[model samples]
Target: MKQDANEFSSFAETIASLGSLTKLESAMSAAIKSSRVPAKETRKMLKCMSIQEAGNTALFQFMRDLFEKVGVGQLVLIRNDIFRYDFAIDNSPVCKLYPHVKGKKTCYITAESLSQFFTKDLGLPGTAEEIACQNAGDNRCEFAVSLQPLAVYQLALDQLDKTIIGSVIDGAGPDKISESLEMSRDEIIFRMNILKRYKILDDDYQITEIGETYHKYGEGMGGDEEEFQPPWKDMAVISNAISASTSFAEAFTEAASQEPLWDVEEKDIVNLAEQAKKSKSFAELLSKQVKSDMEE
Candidate 1:
């Protein structure tokens, strides 16, 4: 009878030990789930390359690669500066926990996190619009990515405006410039007026000294002498060569040949060429510049 009682006591201790082990396991799992620091898997996923000096295309591509590396999902480049991130295969962070939950129209968490990453980490103000989501019963999850800010499109004169100035360098009349640039006559006059306001173009639509400077360095050349400008301003020869070459490849070669004039690496030249290739409008504009150079 005593032996049976001792055996019961041992069984009770064993049961208690099992309970303690289960509790300990549960606590450890909870601690891991609620960890503020990134896990080993997350650290491996976040091994993204630096892109502080990368242009629009490179930046977007890098982000896409980083996301995919972290098991975000496959990314498709919709346009020169836009991407569609689809998170269907392995449910994204936004939908992982709330996979079956319904009634949410947007990926609020994903959008918010991405916005913070772009603005704080990338130094770029951008937007992530979730047009389709798997949680919303869609076959796939999708978000449109744009590197440029909306304010840039709304406030600043665009590539077309600047290209118009480049096309008119040889005193081409509005009619000729319009035909060459494939722009409406009214568009030519409107952009010319804006250039005049900035004192970059005269009444004759000729490029003024300020206009020439602006053409090379953009808004950076506008400030007072004491004000800051990009370090690349000293590389005028290389910049002009790139602008003058008929093709991006040609420009890259020319820039490479004149390496002594600028410290820009060949990889940077390749990146610029790649950026130009990504945009049809930019390619056309460069062609116009090349034609203008020939005329000069």
Candidate 2:
């Protein structure tokens, strides 16, 4: 049997982590920046998940529902692998919209990020290709997550190392990255040297072509799907947080405080806070996000 955790709801944590609605753009920017530079550890993290676990209709449904619950859009699972994420309210403005401008440049970042999320989080094999876009005057945004073969897994970077590489992609020096990522200078130096040894980083701490290619295509094409890890929820703490709160705002704050990893929106947090004041309403709200994660 799996251990029961005393954590807050994952949905509430996601909302709280989003920061203020006013700063959503910056958060999105940060997330985008983080995605551009891939680290070896990121690849390792991705490799931990196998294809058998990720390549299935049920996993796709979970991903689809996750997006919908987060208010990103209404998801239509067109096929086992393909999906249409209709963004009625595009929270990720980083996915540029070329509405009046006549060009077929869809939300490449969004598509790629989704690809990475599926590749890394789910260990599914596919190119998250963008087929349609609202920005292109389409009714919705469509993504063809083609089930394909991941060639191999050939990177071995650790978490801190990957963070450094990602920071470097943002054009930050090792020292600056150290400050930004809160890593010690010595640790940054060590990781940079390792990356350099692997030809992932040049002597000048720049991303080599191989490194660039790895970052660009590795997530979509490398790791083996046979070792995939399933998605999970951390509910106990958030539930306890909610249970302990005297008011909706405190509950919201407690939930938000638990997530330092991702960004969230104030409107969502406020909405969730309002719902969480009543147990029945809150559980119902959580069921929409992730049913299995919440324990009544």
Candidate 3:
């Protein structure tokens, strides 16, 4: 919503502090609902502001700052073109949403539009069908084509890891990085250039000393190296452990709290045991223990 710039900045800072995409989305959605701006418009503006760095660069940067705050990932621009959509999946590509043109024109597709198209026309499973249905209202025929946040998040994370890590380890060009990440070469180059600008790497596609250090010590940098690290490294490890523990707790709760499946007969278990007799380590005693635990 259009709060005073100072007020907006303060609120943005608060949202940034929360550091998780899920939390940020929740906070932003709440703010949008409370603000003078239409909720749908506010959401659309937020999505577009996330991927672009033009007039609304400050706002988008703030959004990206939220990503960094939560320690997930940073938003890096991959491309810009008229009448076309250009972006990277994770940090892999500067994929053009439309064909390129020589002369500049006002023709452009916002990130919202591209997300909608992918969730709708492309038959990408797990797209945000609920959001799409909510946005479309009575025109909900496209609801079947929606994607889930988890699916998108996984795809984005995979692409980012492949691009950034692949480039660092293999000295692969951006094109190779894109291919490895399942993104277009253009997107890889665009995101790589951004990483370069951020001083994460150099123009020669070499990992800078700073980048290497971050790779070794940064949050989520897993390995035995973590044991011999500094206090900040311990802090990162604790944060990661908390995140993992919370996620595991949620998953365990979900599973344990679910309605129990239909019961199986003793005969069924005996028959299954007989069938699994040839299975490796399928001892009758072990199976009995397992069934007993399940029953309890």
lDDT to native, each model: 0.45, 0.46, 0.36
- Residue 67 of model 1: what lDDT? 43
Pairs clashing in candidate 1? none
Candidate number of the best TM-score: 1
Worst 10 residues of 3 by lDDT: 92-101
Query: For each candidate, what TM-score against the reference?
Result: 0.33, 0.31, 0.26
lDDT of 3 by residue, 9-80 (tens): 222221222122223233323222222222222222223322344325443344344333333234444432
C-alpha root-mean-square deviation, candidate 1: 26.9
Candidate 1 residue 164 C-alpha distance from true site, Å: 6.4
TM-score of 3: 0.26
- Model 1: worst 10 consecutive residues (lDDT sum): 38-47
Return the TM-score for candidate 2, rounded to 2 decimals: 0.31
Q: Tell how far residue 82 is off in model 1, in angstroms.
A: 8.1
Scored by lDDT, the top model is 2
Model 3 regions lying over 4 Å from their true place:
1-54, 57-163, 219-296
- What is the C-alpha local distance difference test score of candidate 3? 0.36
RMSD to native, candidate 2 = 20.2
- Better structure of 2 and 3 per lDDT: 2
